[model samples]
Target: MIKSVAHAMIYVLNQDEALDFYKNKLGFEVGDDMKVEGGFRWLTVYPKTQSQLQLVLAEPKEGPLFTKDSAEKIRSLIEEGAFGAGVFETENCQKTYEELVAKGVEFIQPPTEQLYGVEAMGIDNSGNWFSLVQREK
Candidate 1:
C-alpha cells in the first residue's frame, strides 16, 4: 500500500536564489544543503510547523533522474507558469500573506474565503505557484 507523502521536489533555476526565497522570504528552515554525486546539489527546506516534510530544491540538469532535454522542457514549463509546486498550510492565511508581502514576495491573489478554507496564492522565486491555506476552525 502507498504511504503518506514524504516530500516534494521542485526544480529551481538557481539553488542560492531558491534558498534565499524559501528561507528569508517564506521562513522555511533549511533542512539539507550538500552536494551529492555528479556535482548536483541536494538542498531541502521545511516549514517551521511541518518539520518532518521537506521540499527538495533541485536544479534541472543532466543527471540520472533527468536528461538534458527533459530538464530543459521542465524549465520551460516552469517559466511558462504551468506548475503548482506545492501548497503550504498556515495557521492564518491573511497574516502570513502580509508578512510574505512585506518581505517582497509577489502574490497572485490575496486571501479569499471559499467553501473549503481561506487561501492565498503566491509565486516563489522560481516562478512556481504555492497556495497558503488556513482551514476553518
Candidate 2:
C-alpha cells in the first residue's frame, strides 16, 4: 500500500543551475547530492521545514529512462516552459514573491487574491512554472 510521497522529480536543463535556484534563491536545503552507479547524479533538495519530501533535480539525458530523441524532446519542452514543477506553499505569497524576485527569480504573475488564497506564478531557472500560494485560513 502507498503510504506517502517521499520524493518527486523535477526535470531541469542544468542540475547545477537548478541547484542554485532551489537551494540559494528558494532557500531549500540540499538533502542528498552524490554520484550513484553509472555516473548518475542523485541530487535532492527540500524546504528546510519539509525535509520529509525531497525534490529531485534531474537533467534530462540519454539514459535508461530516456533515449536521445526523447531526451531532446523533453529538454525542448522544458525550454519552452511547457512544464510545471508544482505548487509551493508559503505563509505570505506577496512577501515570498518579493523575496524571490529580489534574488533574480522571474515571475509571470504577481501575487493576486484568489478564492482560495493569494497566488503568484513564477518560472524556475529551467523554465518550469510553479505556483506560490498562501492559503486562506
Candidate 3:
C-alpha cells in the first residue's frame, strides 16, 4: 500500500536565495544542508509545524535527477507560473497571512472564505503557487 507523502521537491535557481527566502520569510526551518556525491548539494527545509515533512530545494543542473537542458526548462516553467504546489493547512489563515505579509512575503490573495475553508493564495520565491487554508469550525 502507498504511504503518505514524505516530501516535495522544488527546483530553485539559486540555493542560497531560496534558503533565505524559505527560512527567513516563510518561517521554515532548515532540515538538511550537506554535500553528497558528484559535487551536488542536498538542501531541504520543513515547515515549523510539519517538521517531519521536508521540502527539497534542489538545483536542477546536471546531476542524478536532471540534465542541464531539463533544468533550464524546469526553471523557465516555474518562472512563468506554470506550477501549482497545492495548499498547506494552517490553524488560522488570517493570522498566518498577516504574519507572512508583515515579513515581506508577497501574497496573490488575501484571506477569503471559500466553499472549502478560509484560504489565501501566495507565491514562493520561485513562483510556485500555494494556498494557506484554515478549516471552519
**Candidate numbers, best lDDT first, in rank order:** 2, 1, 3
What digit string (tens of lDDT, one per residue) describes model 1 on residues 20-57?
A: 99999988899999997888888999988887789999
Q: CA lDDT of 77 in candidate 1?
A: 86
Best by TM-score: 2
Which of the predicted structures, 2 or 3, would earn the higher lDDT when compared with the native?
A: 2
Q: lDDT per residue, candidate 3, 60-108, as tens digits?
A: 7888878889988998988898887667789899999999999888899
Which residues of candidate 2, in runs, are more than 4 Å off? none
What TM-score fits each model? 0.93, 0.97, 0.90
Write down the worst ten-residue block by lDDT for model 2.
Answer: 34-43
Candidate 1, run of 10 with poorest lDDT: 2-11
Computed on alpha carbons, the lDDT of every model, listed in order, comes to 0.89, 0.95, 0.87
Worst 10 residues of 3 by lDDT: 81-90
Give Cα distance to truth, residue 15, candidate 3, Å.
1.5
> For each predicted model, how many residue pairs clash, with residues at least 3 apart or on different chains?
0, 0, 0
lDDT score, candidate 1, position 57 = 92
